[model samples]
Target: MMKFRHLRYFVAVAEELNFTHAAERLNMAQPPLSQQTKQMEDDLGTILIERGSRPMRLTRAGGAMLEHATRIW
Candidate 1:
């Protein structure tokens, strides 16, 4: 069920490293953005953001995803 829009969502969050900021940048509500990102992780079967972290960070898989996503853009 992955889509190009999913990658766009991931890229925004990955770049901001914060869901709220990413949501703002995308001009969408935070909840949907979070849900979409969660769906992305679910679809990919890998953890992207380390939600437990204070400042938040991308997991190794997330880092790799970001790299490829940017190129695809």
Candidate 2:
């Protein structure tokens, strides 16, 4: 089961594309935000964020998730 908190975290990170910025926006710390994002990806069984990129990039699955998440809110 997918949690809304995870979805919200994903949406935040997806929109900002920066862990620090997303964390700031969420009023949390970067490490935990990054961890949650990774956990979410793991739980979903897909790589949502491309960690190798400088600013970070979203996988196709992440993009689709963002699209759906935006519509949800």
What TM-score fits each model? Answer: 0.97, 0.92
* Per-residue alpha-carbon lDDT of candidate 2 for residues 1-73, written as tens digits (9 for 90 to 100): 6788888999999999998999999999999988888888888899998999986899999999999998886
Clashing pairs in 2: none
TM-score for candidate 1: 0.97
Q: Residue 30 deviation, candidate 1, in Å?
A: 0.3
List candidate 2 stretches off by more than 4 Å. none
Q: For candidate 1, write residues 1-73 as lDDT tens digits.
A: 8899999999999999999999999999999999999999999999999998979899999999999999997
- CA RMSD of each candidate after superposition: 0.5, 1.0
